[model samples]
Target chain A: MSGPYGTMAEKVLMKGNEAIAEAAILAGCRHYFGYPITPQTEVAAYMAKRMPKIGGTFLQAESEIAAINMVMGVASTGRRTMTSSSSPGISLKAEGLSYLAGCDLPALVVNVERGGPGLGGIQPSQSDYFQATRGAAHGDFRMIVLAPASVQEMADLTMHGFDLADKYRMTSMILADGTMGQMMEPVSLEAPEVKTYDKSWAVTGTDCKRPHNIVNSLYLVPEDLERTNFERYERYRTIEENEVMYEEFMMEDAEICIAAFGVAARVSKNAIMAARAEGIKVGMIRPITLWPFPKAAFKKAAEHVNTFVSVELSMGQMIEDVRLATECARPVVLCNRAGGMIPSPEEVLQRIKEVNGGMTK
Target chain B: MTTQILIAGFGGQGVLFSGKFLAYKAMMEEREVSWLPSYGPEMRGGTANCSVIVSDAPVGSPIVTKPDVLIAMNLPSLDKYENAVAPGGIIIVDSTLIARKVERTDVAVYYIPATQMASDEGITTLANMIILGKLIRVCDAVSNDNLEAALKKVVSARRADMLDLNKKAIELGFNYAD
Candidate 1:
């Protein structure tokens, strides 16, 4: 797989959504169920075009709910299965999300988010941050949320999502905004290092050889449900400790710290470089795993940073996590755009300049 | 070196397709590249644009607010993105469709009658590729070495006959007196 750069992996120019579908296939995902949605239909379209050729199942369900329920059926069989959608459709899939968590099923769900509270515009947005990170559904459960900034990460994390879901026996979400899903970039489609998990609990036909495994989410007894919630929280704590992923840029001597993820992080990097050229001591902490929140990294940055800027596409969602992570010790300001607009590098740099100016006072 | 490019035109003008060609060429040359299109619920007559970045360094943002090269296929696109080009950057306009002079003094502008050239050459649908040829001449968005190889990658095997026609259109623009 060598290319022009000797020994480097050969790369393909693919759209983010297409990369996700391809990577999922490489990761052994044989079943895909999803409805058409803006900014994410390409995921289904790619699967539709390719799945039949490879003897895989690509079902365009009647609705988002039907699609997710179909995912549940395949997931119960302990096979790699997935579904993808955008913001409004993701909301429609929420109950299925809670059920996936409740049943402890392993599956990958991709949310290429667009603007929303209702039927929002089919434009790139990170407004689903609160919906993805905090309130995916009604119950008290957390899904492993991975945010990808580039198309390369979109593919890399799709493979990673499946592995994580299998390891943790729950749903793993690719929480990308429309920009990440729609952009095209060069990506190496090499197979990822995979770790297999024991799926003996899966409800495959027993053939009268062993006891039939039952897959159910209902716990009629209140205490039984409480125990399951406690057990899930215990697993969450373990994931927070062992699976937190983040990247730090120019944080060695930073006076201003910017907290962002996905596309906001990409724009912030551009702004950070410009600020450094102008001699502003600013850096960024980009959380790759949104659920874990990278609390320790932000807490450490808070110890030295004079100000923290929470850049987002939402009104303000991850900013609350930034505040909680930093213990509100540093003043965290918002540099944001809502309803499908992105905060440009100029806007982010301007915010940094303002935060630095306030430090002198 | 990092070159941010913005290509804009009518929806049917192959704006995104041309950007794809440039991105594929850059990838073939082992440069870090990205192509991001302005996608949504738009019909054929609506305006469409694409942002492309070809860089020696990793591309930070795929959304190019300040492009080093601007390829405008129509007047509306020119009026929209003319002011957005960086100082001393290159602006390549399809002169046959956009009848106005560029009003920017800070950037170098190229007015190529791409549509006219393509129509004259009986390759009307390739005005995008014609302007793209001029784009490569004006800036190092992609190397000329991998142009055909890149074209082979994007123009599906079913349309293999188009490979030579596209190359001819590109050569037409590359050697155009304008």
Candidate 2:
């Protein structure tokens, strides 16, 4: 963090996309392959500018699929690689994602999501919740989804994503929305201590030193594929037990809880504060990890709160996770906006008030 | 206290740049700040806007719903966001472009012909800086100290010549009365 970028502790104003790019470099990511898409194009642009300067490769692939395959190529060689795209582009990368999971390759895929279902709009959204958590493509695999709520987390999580991807030998996705990708805030570029893993299994040149390392997802034997699936799930279980991250705001002695992440979580924080000011016992459990879903946090909050309001930019995409996490022990209601519209603090505050009224009645 | 400011105008008018200046000024002062610009097709000669928040505590939502201060550089921006300003907030209109007067009486309004002034001053592209200067003069959104340093950061190295003109335009707006 300190070298080359100089004065790493000094805060600099940066867009969320720029932060991600710079952090990726700090994390030793030398290969970036991405195609342009709205609301997330800055990420590619930033890489195109910085990667060359850092002696890294920033290739603008012909398509999203091509870009993801390029990522796979670098990942097979055991080098840090990344690709970023928006909603539609991410959909195109689905097959590649499943392939990576099948090959057990570690890589970073950033989804600066815009409204979706099909080229929805160039505005912020969380509609890809199911797509991200359920392993975007047709497969019995999982990608560690990190939901960053701020520009700072955008940078922090980019570095963390690289580490986690290497650690679990699986793809770690930074599931950010348009707002989190576009907004600017003061961030410290102070490099974090990066952790490296052994890449003995990488497809490096054998040079007649040993057997050539092969990387492939196709398993001709059904039993071999089944065993690999079981092993991947075992890794996922360890991740679920260890990598769940969340923040609790004003949950102490609270009767109402809000479950949100990314921009929705930020908006919910404002509402929780306003509701608290008005003497309402409202709090929030902001999940930093979406795939693992922070089930423990929700289950614990369900024990104390009367109702859980799920705020999101999409039409309650994350609500299903909230209900399942809490095991339907408490009522989970939706406060959301769709088609790229974001919920205002006042809207969420009103929902909190309504939920409080229902509880009282 | 948190000050939520929104800047709106056509794409070429530096609406996002003005927000960046304010955000950088606040950041230099060690305050929590965020700047969010409208992106997508809007940047290709369409309406562009930016949301900036300066807060004592960490910023929550980067989107400004009810702005404490509104800078309207064009008619559509004024018409669309006039009613969205918080009561007792401040509204600065670029009289050179926006023809109509703000109908809201709850918020204080300042009509600075920034576009006209910048034209007169031979710095037509810097009307955004002029309005920013007026914002600093009228309200303590950000202090004028380190203004040059902030401008230095935002205005790229290639366009360093605009630095002095930008400063002059801001001074013109800062000194304007009535």
Q: How far off is residue A167 in model 1, in Å?
A: 0.8
TM-score (C-alpha, index-matched) for candidate 2: 0.97
Q: Which candidate leads in DockQ?
A: 1
lDDT comparing candidate 1 with the true structure: 0.92
Sliding window of 10 residues with minimal summed lDDT for model 1 chain A: A1-10
For all predictions, the C-alpha RMSD in Å is: 1.6, 2.3
Task: For candidate 1, write residues B59-139 as lDDT tens digits.
Answer: 888899999999999989999999989999999989999999999999999999999999999999999999888887778
Candidate 1's residue-wise lDDT over A1-361, tens digit each?
5643345457888999999999999899999999999999999999999999999999999999999999999999999999999999999999999999999999999999999889989989998888888999999999999999888789989999999999999999999999998999988887777677999989999999999998889999999999999999999999999999999999999999999999999999999999999999999999999997899999999999999999999999999999999999989999999999999999999999999899421
A262-360 per-residue lDDT for model 2 (tens digits): 999888889989999999999888889897889988888888889999898887788899889899998999899989999999999999999999942
Regions of candidate 1 where Cα sits further than 4 Å from its true position? A1-8, A359-361
After TM-score superposition, what is the CA distance of residue A10 in candidate 1 from its true location, in Å?
A: 1.3
Q: Output the worst ten-in-a-row residue range by lDDT, candidate 2 chain A.
A: A1-10
Interface RMSD, per-candidate values to 1 decimal: 1.3, 3.3
For B36-152, candidate 2 gives per-residue lDDT tens digits of 998868754799999999998999999998999999999999999999999999999999998888999999999999999999888889999998889999988788776789889
